[model samples]
Target: MDAEHIRAIAQQTGCTHIHPGYGFLSESPQLASLFPEGGAIVFIGPSTGTLRVASDKMQSRALAVHNGVPVAPGAHVSSAEDVHKFVEGLGSAPFPIIIKALDGGGGRGIRLVYAEDHIDHAFRRCVGESASRRVFAEKAFVGPGWRHVEVQIVGDGLGNVSHLWERECSVQRRFQKVVEMAPSTLPRDTVGHVIEAALKMARHLQYKSLGTFEFLIDDHAKHWIFLEINPRIQVEHTVTEELLNIDLVKAQLQLSLPKASLEVVLPAWTMSPQPSPPPGYAIQLRLVAEDPHKDFRLSTGTIGPADVFWPSGRGVRVDTWLSTGPYYRGGLQWAVGVDFDSLLAKIVVHAGTFQEASARALRALRETRIAGDVKTNVEILSGVIAHQDWSSGRIYTQWLEEKVDQLVQLGNTQLTRQSRGSLSDTAAPRRLSGGTESATATALLQPGASFQLSLSPSLPQAASGQQTQKHTLVISSIGRNAFPNELSGTITTSLSAMPLSFSLSQLSSIMASAHTEFANPADPSHVASPIAGKIVELHPALETVAGDANKGSYVRKGEPLVVISVMKMESVVNAPASGRVVRVGRGIEVGNIVAEGALLCVLDVTDMDKGLARL
Candidate 1:
């Protein structure tokens, strides 16, 4: 919400009460305090002191340990001496120790201590980060495996508290939860113990309002430790809402209002009441602008030609901040600006089975086209869906690490197919007569060599440092795409054969001759557009750079003809190796499209003083 609009709304609505969702203004006691003073709104949350206490990672860990809640072993250090003091005691704990910034969470201020020698470097880095982000450190949670379990609780104004069932949020990437579902995969007794600890913590602080206590469950399922508590609504709150018919937001408002009466509608919380896994399964894939496979850095800019078709049959919900119209109705127009671009557009899908839902969502995501500088990690998410581990429900917090290469390949493949308009047609392997293959090979290469050959700008060399420069380029079996394992030995070249097996290096290095025919050739000024789109820039050099044809006002063929951009692909057309500038036109941008050989700019291939020969 914008500033002016929010203020106007506050004025009109009388600002009786405000409940900022989690990660927003939810835990801001200072902002909450402003409500009562302004005599307009009331902030619904705990006291300012409690907010400070919960926000501090070290302080919270100490509290949890003091209250008999198990926590990972580690001491909060402030400087180098503090680290020296604690390092001696960390006997046999393993190599990868975690050093997290006290004030930071959500995987931002965290580093892995890979080796003993790296501890000092890791410690110093964390200290600097802590000072900057106002955080401290504790022993990182290193175990066989980690499971994120969260419990949502509501407190009555009179100090009565109740715990809703816990949700297992173990599926993650970059420490951010991607998929969360109700009824944790942990044991029933473990869930009870965590809930008991959570209630104790809440009572100790007298926290009144909606809150969630987080815990890290180790691999053995024998040990569960309290991590900390999120003082506001989380992004995954929908998971709990889906499992339980209760609206947590409404409950929070009622509980915060002192005069509002309370009702015991939900029965005393029981573990078995989690609704038997909801019949089918549901998964929410966060459509983040930033690439998870690419360091998770913030990727900003507009998403053009944005159009979304929601699945409305049933069991599907789309929570997004996207719209369309003349502003973005055209095929490749920008929808959002650079700012507010990094946020996600979440797609919640549900089906009778996990596989079905995942497949449906994948299809929907790929079919829709969202162009512009703002790139989404839709390809990565699809890869996860297709992965055997993910599809089989064996996903873990670090699953993405093992599948990084696969994700990158999938992303690049999608981008290439989309750009080239090759996504539509899936061709079958063509079968050529043995004689035909032999004849084509003999025709296109030197004596005894098989196939036509042209090297691209980049010639790929093998690990042996040997660059193959022959008609039938040789490649390792692995580099050849879709070739049968049996034929990987030595498949002779065949130019006429379709779906030919070639290495990526081979394809990229295949360049047509400079004099390759363009069907209807023209002079420098007669030469057409560079890109496959409408004109965008026509340099003034058409006359000066290409001299004059008749009265020196004419262009001396063979120069930068013109610039055009189609489907976002841009290039400047120069004389077909050499030509003269004849005609120049207006500029073009994002929305225009051009045919194979449409006359965009004209060039004259004539001999002049400033022509190719002159150079």
Candidate 2:
């Protein structure tokens, strides 16, 4: 992550030229400037002086002030007192404040303080969260329809700059861009101002090569404020390239050449031979293997076969870092772990109109199926492009957070139905002959139906990602007659190639057995563990705050019975209903390891049903 480590690698690999790309050392002035001392390697980016000012949010804010660029009114706050001082300086800039990492990226180190009381905690949290150990406070840009617009700039080493228009990066989650579109639709004068501001900063810093100037467009106030300067090629660079028929990375390389000039750098893109600026619109969506409903946590575990389809022809392009599908690990099963960024690919579409491009991109995503139970954000992507706000170009940075629930629901239904249909495709049995229509699933599972299923041996490969152990295989073959209604295949997650026979009459039972998860909550007879965790707090069924254990006292539903800590998250085991605890779990203490479905304590909830229903 530091310059020395990267330098060591460059030396070890004998690379004469190094591209820091976007994260880590991309904005490190120390890395960029110090690398020139090596004399053998060239860093394809801005000068150390430019990056020094651009990478530091505080310094960048100062630069904006000098250039008369509008910036969100705020200050560099190192302590709680400084936060108050900056807020007081705003006068009428509202109460809530936002604390940000001075050098953080990807929205990792940011906290919004909603009230005066939370400033201390939020400031402390932000300080610890930021890798640079520096935090800045800014006037929270509140109100509706706040958008993100970035101007793409290419500067020669001589303070000369050219603009490639702007990009709308309004659709975001966690303050990070999720979808980016070029040729942003904004007021013409306002767009021109943004471009002018970007070029001014580039000239001010003598910025060279590729860089992006980010801004926060407050639609309510009809104003745009300076945010930061990304002194490297960005993830959404493809959008601008698609609209202009240019290669930005190649341009970055050309800038580092001897006696490099704009015309000499990329004649086709920036010279006389350059064609007219391409027309139409282009939209790009970053597809990641994450579930939106679950707070976009890592979906690292079992990875099944990936049936990725990259659309050909026209303006459709999918750029991915992973070439092949996930493979077996530890000589057992297929899986993908959280070793790298969850970004699986970027889907870019260029068409005659925005609607057409949006439609085309959606089609490509739905078809680019990553098979198995691998959860992805495709359905979320689908919802975004099709949403009314997005279609009207009225999106904001928090649009994804606002539409998370609706998007997740749509995605769940789509994915669940897809998985359910996969079962139908995989569980076909006896074929009917001399008939026009095919047999229904019910007919196949009826008596006298014969079918065959397939299975694969569990084989492991050398672990490459973060996880080493074998993850449970999500998909397993099940022929029509191979499994009966009584027996299910869900029990064979780790097993491989085991053949079994069952009756067709057991279809209903088989489906239930294969799909049933955890323990049934409908039956309160068994108070099993809902998740694998440790019993960090075992309380009496009914206890007085004065330290009296009332064993026979009635426990109300939703009352905390046990507290379990799993993976740093705490989950409370609640009383299912108003019932007396028959017995406290034996040997269960403040710290006892409990597996999922492990018995916690028995509850006499005979009357809980009626009481809970009434409640």
TM-score top scorer: 2
Off by over 4 Å in 2: 267-278, 302-307, 325-335, 409-615
Q: Each prediction's Cα lDDT score?
A: 0.53, 0.66
Which portions of model 1 show Cα errors greater than 4 Å?
A: 1-14, 36-40, 116-133, 186-189, 261-280, 292-296, 305-312, 324-341, 351-369, 407-615
lDDT of 2 by residue, 247-319 (tens): 8999899998767787766544544322333478899999886766556654443332233435456788889
lDDT of 1 by residue, 1-615 (tens): 343455458779887776666653565555555555236666677656667777777778877988999887777776656665565676765445577776555554566666666666556545544434343434566433667788887665445566776777776665667666565655677677788888888877777777889998775656778887778777776656654556777777766665543354343443332332334455666777654544543343333222233333455566765545445444442333222334456666656565676675665555544433345777776666666666655655566655667865775564344344423322211223221111011112121211222322232233234332323333322433332111234445443322333321111111112211122332334343322334444455553433443422233334444544322223445545444444432222223333223344444444454654444
C-alpha TM-score for every candidate:
0.59, 0.68
Worst 10 residues of 2 by lDDT: 502-511
